[model samples]
Structures are given as structure tokens and as C-alpha cells.
Target: MSATVSREGNASVAGVNGPVLGDADFRFLREFVLQHCGIALSEQKRQLVQGRLLRRLRALNMKDFGSYCDLLRRDPDGEMGDLASAISTNVTSFFRESHHYDLLEKTLIPQWLAHKRRQGDRLRIWSAGCSTGEEPYALAMVLAEALEKHGAPFDAKILATDLSPQALQGAREGVYSLDKMDGISAERRRRWFLRGEGSYEGLACIHPRLRELVTIQPLNLLHDWPMAGLFDAIFCRNVVIYFDKPTKERLFSRYAKQLEPEGYLFLGHSESMHGLSDDFDLVGRTVYRKRAS
Candidate 1:
């Protein structure tokens, strides 16, 4: 459950180069990835996959692609997260898409908080495929402000999930480099982040208040989810670009089921639900609302 795949060569391997990925191994890998991660790898992407997975092969002290395939065959679930990480890109930033947050801050949250205050209901936002925690933390800032403004004792939380263990660990740590703070405004920088000093200089740790609102967890979007409760909104931006039509359809349908009626489903700028699913209606740029059934 992540964004576009990286085409860069794998340089993190222990060795200078990796063994060539054979045709049989490549085929097995394509099928395995599609089956497990819902990513359809075309024939042209073989070299890219080989290059990216080379680091894994070298790290595991493997000599051949066949052996890697064997490892996957033996323990698919155990290795799926790392495998997905190797192939997918975790490129994300705080407030990557600002307008979505604007809608939430200006309209959606106010309305929801008002209703929740009266109904004594909980507020939930699911940051599906929330890479490295930025999305959910940015979401938390907005949520915290709204809750304070409304002055309600609402049970509100943001569920931040990703398929990469590395990403989830980063999210849980809530620390970031100074350069990564570009998308964040100066005011938010002071308000929501504590600037580091001395040896930890140039890095900023997220405020404790934001951390309280977000629950970072590892999750694969294609697999079964443990969350039984429905969400008020789900932000799944940029993560569906690699999924094929059938996969997208299935994912969207599942998202609809997991959403409250009329809940929002936000997609990436490039993604579209057109001719894919009937459960959602296009409401704004890359934004969809669950159709009332």
C-alpha cells in the first residue's frame, strides 16, 4: 500500500552487483507481487524490479534470483512488507495536497465536530497508505485545531497505515529532517514541531499533541484489515497508481464498505474512479464522496 515504484538501481546492497534475475524468477516475482500487493508489473518493469531487489538479494546473502523466489515461496507473509518496500516508492511530505486539508479544515471538520458534539459520536480519519507519517501528522494538526476551536470532548483519532515497516518505524518516531519541513508553514513549524539542538540539530520532532491523535501501524491494503469500525473519511492518495483495474475496483469497493455512508474517499491527483466503481461520486479534484445507497 504505497505510491509509484522507484526506477533507481539498488545501491544499498552489500555487494557491487546482484545476480541477474532469470526469466522464471522474474515471472514468479511478477505473479507474487500482484497476488500479494495488488501491483501489476508489466514486462518492461523487469529490469527495474531486478535493480531494486538487488539490495535485498545481497542483504539476504543470496547469490541468485531463484533463491529469492524460493524464500518468497517458503514464507510469503513474513517477507511481503520488505518486498513491497523494495519495489514501491515512499515519497511523501507534510500537506502534500493542500486543498484536501483546506476542505477538511474549512468545511468537513467543522460540520462533523458540530454533529459529533450533539450525538456524542467519535470522529475517525483513516490515512490509508500513510507513508512515513506526514499525512496523518498533518491531519492531526488540523484535527487538533478544530477540536480546540469547537471545544468538544469528541473521541477523535487518525489511523495512519502503510505496508513498509521502515516507513512505519519512521512514523512512530515522529522525527524529521529540516528539509522535509518545506511543505509545512512557518507558524505550524513552531506550533507543531520542537526543533532539535546540539547533536540532533536540524531535525524536528513532532509535537506530543499530534502524536496523541495518530496511531501509526503497518498494514497492506490488499490484505484483510483488523479495523471493524467504519471511517468518516479515508485518505488513500497516490497509492493506487500501480494497481490494475480489477485491483482498483476491488480496493474501492472494500473502501466503500469500510466507510460510513457519504464518507469521503480522497485519491491522488493522478488517480480516478471513472468507469471503475459506482460506490463513489466525484466531488472535487481527486476527491470522491461515497454515494448513498
Candidate 2:
């Protein structure tokens, strides 16, 4: 038999049964999430949302989805971040997209270092939506290796930003299980990570030098960005696919403005900027270079 609500309005589907996330609740959450974080949710995602937020409902002792929505309206800070965290997909690994690193090492870094050497300048890279730190840390490793190979003392730093505080906390910790090192070479792993021992055996933490090269910050791309300087390259992979077309257009435009004239922008393998913005030209697979004007 289908679960029925008690007179007290306590959730009928609590525990193993799961909360009943109705159409109204799904609509409310969809609109709220899109308005706040620009993450558009389709009707098909109703089940997905219900599954992701069931724990939140149980955590708050909410009797119904309406109560959760009311809580959101009354105290957004109390639940919004958690909601974002629950909804965010943080699947990443060290050097998940090896080709991007190859481009950074073979072409982008070398050319930019040559120009910067002439100007006596430092390099800046932004890893927008850098969930759990892998992307930025990979960039750091590649940059460090390239600098060492070139025998140059060029200053460089990476700004890694994400909307989820939970993910940022993991990024800041810079620790991961040993199995997550599959993509990293033994030499690279030895150079960039410290093997954890004792109770922390089977884990690894990024070395001090690599950690120092990346700064993790909590940022919502839909909100105001306080960064002042332009970037030499911006890696915003796998991020905008969740946003609507208009949101994507505005963000791509903003990235163009924030990038140097010759700067590069990298997107996920499944994402493209073909109709989003004309300020950048497609130069490589899932990569764009800002037009020289």
C-alpha cells in the first residue's frame, strides 16, 4: 500500500520509504535553484532532485516538502548552501582531461612564459568550478613541471573557485585516497604529493609547493566576482552545462572580458561555445582563444 500521512503531518515516507517530493515542491526547488545558482532543472530531473534532497528533509525533521520550502524562504542561509552542495556534481580526478594538460604544457604555457619573460610578469590561471581541487592542482603540477623544464623562474598562481563550501573544504584539505592517483604518473605523484602514513595510510596529500600554487575560494559564478586582474587562461570545464543558454552566454562574455586578449578558455569535453560568444575562436578540442583585437 502507498504510504499515508499521519494527522500530525509527519512525513509518511520517512526512513526507508523516502519523502514524497510532489510536483509543487519540485517546481519550487527548480525555480529557486535556477534563480540563485543559474542551474536549470528540467521536469525530468524531478526524481533526481527528490533523491538528492531526501537526506536534507530527514535532517531537518521536515514532515513534508512544503515545510522544507518554507524553511528555505524563512532562512535561506540555513539550507541554501546545503542544497547547492547536495545538488552539485563533484566528479573529478587528478588530470581527468589529460589533453588539456598537454596543451598547457606543449603550447599555452611555453608561449605565455616567453611573452611574460620579456615583460617580467607573473602568470594567473583561474579554475572556475574547481570541484574538490583536482583540476587546479593538475594545472599547478603542469605549470610547475613546465617551468622546471624551461629552467625559468617565472611566477605563477592558480585561483580555484567553487560554489559548494563542502567541496571547497575538501579542496583546501588537499588529501585524497591513493586509488585516486590512477591518472597521475609515479614520478609526478612522487614530486607533487606526500604519502600519508599511520592512521592516514592509503591516502595522499598534495605537497606544500603544489598546494601553495593554488588558492581555493568560495565563489558562485552567477554572483559578483571580486577578482580585479585578468587571467592568462581560465579552465571552466564541465560547469556551464548546468546553466541555461542565456546564463551561458552572459558567463562566456564575462570570461572573455576577464581573459587577456591572447588568453585561452577551456571547457568540458561535452560543452561548446560555438553560439554562446564570438569573442573567442575555437583553436583546439574544447578550447578557445580570445580574439586579438
Best by TM-score: 1
lDDT of each: 0.89, 0.87
RMSD of each: 6.1, 2.8
Query: Considering summed lDDT, which 10 consecutive residues are worst modelled in model 2?
Result: 6-15
Clashes of 2: 0
Tens digits of per-residue lDDT, candidate 2, 1-293, equal 25655434433454456667766667778899998888999888877788878878888887667788888888875566688888878788889879999988998899988989999988999999999999999999998888888796778999999888788998999999988899999999889999888977889999898887899998889889999999999999999989999999999999999998879999999999988898999999998999998
Q: Can you write out model 1's per-residue Cα lDDT over 1-293, one digit (the tens) per residue?
A: 11222123322222245466656677788999999999999999988998998889878988667778889999998889899999998889999889999999999999988887888889999999998899999999999999889874679999999998888999998999999999989999999999888876889999999999999888999988999899999999999998989999999999999998899999998899999999999999999999999
Best of the candidates, lDDT: 1
- The backbone clash count of each candidate, in order, is 0, 0
Runs with alpha carbons beyond 4 Å of true place in candidate 2: 1-16, 150-152
